[model samples]
Target: MNILFYNDSQDQLFHISPRQRRVALAVALIMAFLTLAALFFAGTKLPVMSAFFPVLGAWGVMGDVLTSFILFNQFRSSRIFPLLLLACTFLLTGILSLFYLLSLTGMLPLSGLFASGSQTAVWLWCFWHSCFPLGILLFMGSLHFNKKIIDRRLLPRYLFSGTTAVLLIGVLLLALATAGQDKLPVLIEDGNYRRLIETAVGPAIWALCALASVCSVFPYKKRGVLRVWLSVAVFAFLLGVTLSLAAGERYTLGWYGARIDSLIASTVVLLSIISEVNKLFVRLRRQHEELEESQQALESANEQLKELSGIDSLTRIANRRKFDEVLKQELNAPQRAKEHLSLLMIDIDFFKAYNDHYGHLGGDMVLRSVAPRLEAEALAHFGFTARYGGEEFAIILPGHSELEAEQIAELMLESVRSLAIPHQYSDVSDQITISIGGCTLRPGEKSNAHDFIGRADEALYRAKHEGRARFVFANSARDSCLHPFETTSH
Candidate 1:
């Protein structure tokens, strides 16, 4: 749904959705079929001719040819590629028919001027035959090279080989043509410099086409090299045509001009196909990178959600559920490991009375204050702490003995007492304080975590009953005695 704007310098907008891919594929296939049909029926041999038919036929054929080329090179596995390649072969045959039509339609001005028995006619016939096979070979070669480079990462190696092959073959063919031209007396006798130029130009144009085809395999950064070769090919074709016309043997000039025009048009079309293929690759790569980034962002968000779920929202610590799980794990450790485990049960003294006098908000502030103080004391003793319930918290000291546990409890009591907030309506004492009760147990001592916790709770009950501001050891007999004031009342 998000809109993205690409400046003119950038490649076209890439459609990434499955629906768009299907649509593009369908368009490509339809174009391929139409091009094939036009190429098949577009000549004098096909007698169903309406006046508008040939023009419509040429447009359909051109559209099909270009679309087929695009689908084959840019989306090889698409149903479009194989279909288009097949259509292109038929399309080439139709172009051959058009060449024959041009000869029959008397549009070839040079054919009558050069007598039927003349060497010029023979050379023209040979050249015409060469054109069909040459066009087909170049088309197939370009497509084969394009597919190989597109589907494989070893572009440099294949490109080097293809380029070398094209260069050698093109130079050899040009040399053979030039040598043959030297012996054509009709060319020599008539001073037909145009025929000589045509003979020389054909090989150079083909060479340049081959070079352009090979250059298309390179990455964008190196495409300028390919562009340079194509420019050379275009210059040779144009210069050769100009030189042929200037040489002024009327018959030779007309014949060479027709061939030059066909070569130039085909070269332009092939170059356009290469450019579009490059554009498509660039767009697809960008979309792939964006998808990877989005996936990474999603993974990070999921990990954070998992962390948040295990944390206590109000206290910003591990919740009671997490605490129980960790406690059970510690309690189940093997006895031979000789580990000492301690638990502390802490309560904010006279919390109910405090809440009644100052309101629940004030009770919350007191609870918040007491929890952190206990946390700091527990951390100082290298223990873990969590809020056990409203106004109560628990700390686990995994390696601490009974003496160390008692000492930590005393430290927590002192830390809370030091807060020194006044509590005027409390029966226990006049200052806000905490009661801490802790128990230390060894692993494999026939004690479950619940038993250890129950002992700590019992001591906590005794601490609250006995003046409410002191630490009570779980096994101490003094913890079993009630407060002196409460005992007197009983």
Candidate 2:
């Protein structure tokens, strides 16, 4: 069933543990402590770094864009409005950071992609920093109103509006930084920003950040992994902004430390998303392997069922059904165009008389003993044996001539006589004996399987009337016959 919220098992953020919350808290405190140490050395000047601003700005741009993409993807699935707002903030941060890098004076050969002038980088940085926490505040506030599932039809509109708003804000900031620079307060001057900058604008941005943190903690009582990490990230950015504002000069320890904090803040959520994706992929691969094993086992069971259907339950060999199928197959086999095949019909003498004297149980025992002995002799001739009916058995011999069939029939008779099962009611002898009748014929266009079996039965009747222990023969192979379809290959 579809729930009110889009539940994703892969999204660890949806199910935060107490340990994770503690770890997140510890991380926030550590960054806070480190930033305070950097602030203590705020005015200490260091060697100038020509590539630091551009490289760090570029790194922040890539990280922010990736984080925005991950959050946006989640928003698309869940249709959660706050997630879209949060994603837009990241995208805005990335776009503005790029502009900030390009506007810097003599930092790199790359410049003028958007607005490049005095204080243009500073104003753009302010907008980027201030707008992000404002976005966070809105996100935390909106979570309260999102008790129902979002309508999927509104998804495209929400996505387009959120992204467009970020771009429009970026364009407005560019205008203020470039065209209306004279109207704005000076945030950066003489390659340093100390009392005037820190006292007015820095504290205001800090207050905005502090309010955003309060919204996350109080209104949103149910904490998720993403929200906790976002709070930690916002806290880090707050300290980084404080560090940058306190630094009296461009090449101070505070300036570099602030950039380090920015780097950590930008990559934290993105790394978590990557780890979540890796875990899901491993689980999917394991499920696929298990499904394949189940399918293989099912196929094996089906094959065994088919084999069982053709088997005789009583004799543990081919029954009448299997014998009929094999007889039909042997008749149609293409090798019959060159060679002959034989069929044998076997019957024990005085079987019913034996049953009347010793009871049906004793007759059943005699039949069971006689079947395997015939099968053993038939196997030597590359033939198969089946229980045809009561006290009667049949054997099929492929690629056997009339003379070879006759020889095998004699061996089958001898094999049964050797059993010496006592049959006191027998008219022939005290010992159990069997009668054999067989036929050998090559396949032809005119060959009839029923006629072949009838001829063998006729021979068996003659053997029964003429003394039971002997073998009788029917029609042998007629070489001069109609050619089979296999004789002419297309």
Candidate 3:
């Protein structure tokens, strides 16, 4: 779902479908034909053609600005060297285009902004076009010789310093050119010949762009779509340069043709970036949805795990750990002070002797059998049951008084006796039996939950001491009860 298309293992915009390639080629050919036709037809008429050149120049500037923004966004995310250079080049192209446009229309505040004198605009035009090729050459060099220069931490400083230096140098050169404009010959005048500076600089800039375009073709074993497109843009730019020289004067047919070619070059890069951004947005949305679903599934799993950790595996009841947690809550809970709460600690009488006679498996079976009976008595009276340990269980009655707890304990005793499980080695009786001890108190009476459990344990010990198959109630003198059972049916 990560739609960030790049050249390595990632999805790249360079891999175009056959239909898309065809469409692109058609558009390129159309633009080239239109440019050539316009240049040839407009050559004879200067006044009509001059008015449209400014508009085309402005369109070129806007396209360069947009392409620069797209590249900058890519650079911010990837911090790649080539993207940075391309972004900077596009930005410079935009600024230079604006100056060229303003100077051609006589709107520039300073005469030196875009020209030295008669050919000042032409010199600025050469510098503006040269920046792109220079940036591409640097990008190529970074790919091969300076691979480590793409450090994210240093990129901002490099961009700022480089941009500032470029601006400063441009300003200084324009000023110097303006001061020397008077001495420079008018190359476009009726009889004035072109000077060496004008003759040499323009062709040299065009040559650099051509050389860079050629260099771009062999960066890797196979050429990528991006490289091919870059070369195409450079070639188109070179064509525009040739058209400008052929026009030999401002506002001529060749001037309009050159501006149109520049506009087309900027548009090509802009269109590709737009397509890439659209794909990226779709991918980001899909990843976000997938992340939300995973979060919900993880939350459900955690809840199940929490429930399992508090349960007893063998008896299928709340375990000792759960019992301790509930007891602590009840003892400290403020609402418990308004009602009676009782703790019943029950133990299987002579369970050790029963295990010796019946084996560990039999002991486990007995524990399981007794657990449900305890739970039934506790639940029937609005209480909770838990297995405190082997052959022992605890019950919590939240709103029950001492008398009600005693009755429930007696019912539990009868429920277990009804099972009639055999125990020949038991000293008490031939049938299985249990001893119950209970304590009832308001939660505020005890300082801690463990103190309450300690008092209940004392009562259970007393029940065992007196005799098995009996119930002992311990809380206050008014609530104390020691109910013993007589010998029953064998």
Candidate 4:
């Protein structure tokens, strides 16, 4: 199963499950309740914690850096613009956090490299919080604006120019906040000062960020994996902002809770990316198994086809084509001269008359019956057999002399007659009979397959002319009665 699938061509869409959307919604609801409670306690001050800002600032820098790097890697796979924006958004937040920490610690502007004051850290915090939601708002809305996939050739240009633009914007904002902190209205409500968020600016910023988060998780719309998680992230950031500046007081319960909300914002998207990686591994493993099974099935089919191509369908013996191929291979083999090769040809007697009387079906039965006996006797002598043509068969006896070849041929003659199948049309006997002719010769460098087969075929013609059922060897003549085993069934 494809566990998660992003629309690589579309900037802000993917296929997602109901469970994922439900989980995002759950986080939004839980955070919303907590944020409301924190706002209720916003005006109430708590014990001042000096380490709170430093701890949160360090975490924000590290967390946003990790989150941005992951999204940047994801953007490479899809070439989507929203992914790039999300990456840059995280990067901006991370850099702003770093500067805020450095300025607050009095570690920045080392050796007068830059300038900062007591208000620099608070303004940096304002810019960081403000840009994060704005970036996310653009990311979700760009779903309609950027529909086509960016070409690979144009990716570098987009990356460089886009990154350059964000960097410049961040630099200008840093300069405004740091070198000119006195001119701008202070955001932090320290001592007798008032918070900017508590006045007319409060409702506008909250409404806009809340709208962006709420729209992303619209119940009727399809919220994909990335969008769902990002929706959760933005809502968490909304909660942080709500808790931090709505009361305009430091060391309040909401002030501490805002840092926790910021952490949730960075973690949610990282969780989504991790889920994607795990599913990809599972998909690759399944594909590997399928590929192995397909390979085995193909190999098995090839073996069956190879066997079928060489086998005779009717008689269950090797076909004439297979016989020709085997003979040529053995004759031309490098080790052929080390032993003798024997070719024996057999023919049924008066087979035309038998078929004319019994019809072709009966004739087929006789041929099938005769083929097995020939094969059995040939195999007993360590020989190979094939059906040469209609009413004819051949055998090859490797490492056999003319005496061994003749003995095997004679045994085949007796075996066929012993079947006791009635012929009724043969001149030789009341039962079917066959003529055998064989030749045994050591294979030489110049040996040809046709010459070896023809020598045996010549002997078979002589055997048929001499008698209907008899054995003949090409090299010499022998009287059948002279052998100890003689059959008179034919």
How accurate locally is residue 121 in candidate 4, as Cα lDDT from 0 to 100?
A: 70
Lowest lDDT 10-mer window, candidate 2? 479-488
| TM-score of candidate 3 on Cα atoms, chains taken together | 0.54
The segments of candidate 4 whose C-alpha lies over 4 angstroms from its true place after superposition are 1-14, 110-113, 189-193, 198-203, 218-220, 286-490
Every model's Cα RMSD, please?
20.4, 20.6, 19.7, 20.5
lDDT of 4 by residue, 357-473 (tens): 999999999999999898888888877789999999999888787777777777777788889889888888788889888887865635578788888999888788786588788
Clashes of 1: 0
lDDT of 1 by residue, 1-490 (tens): 0001123111112323454335433533453354334333322132233333334334433543553344334333322222233334324423433333333333334423321223433244234334434543454354434332133444334345533544454334333333343355443234333454456644554454445434332333222222232233333333333333343442333333334333443344345445545767888899999999988996896577447546666666556876786688678866416877888888887888999999988887787777788878887887878888888888989888777787777677667777877888777767787787877786546577778899999988877776677667787534322231333111
**Residue 132 error, candidate 2, Å:** 0.6
Please say which candidate is ahead in TM-score: 1 or 3: 3
TM-score of each prediction = 0.35, 0.58, 0.54, 0.57
Q: Once model 2 is optimally superposed onto the true structure by TM-score, how far is the C-alpha of residue 9 displaced, in angstroms?
A: 14
In the range 1-490, model 2's lDDT, one tens digit per residue, is 1211325422235566687788888988898888888888987888889888678878888999999998888888876666787899889988887777777743423344343566777778788778878888777666666544469998888889989989998888887887777788887777665643655777788788777766655534455677667877787788878888778567789888888878777877787567656666888899989989988996896577448647666666678887887888788887888878898998889898989989988988988899989988898888989888888999999888887888788777767878878877777677898988887786553357798888888888877877677668875432111111112111
Ten-residue region with minimum lDDT total, candidate 1: 1-10
**lDDT of model 3, residue 488:** 32
| Candidate numbers sorted by TM-score from highest down | 2, 4, 3, 1
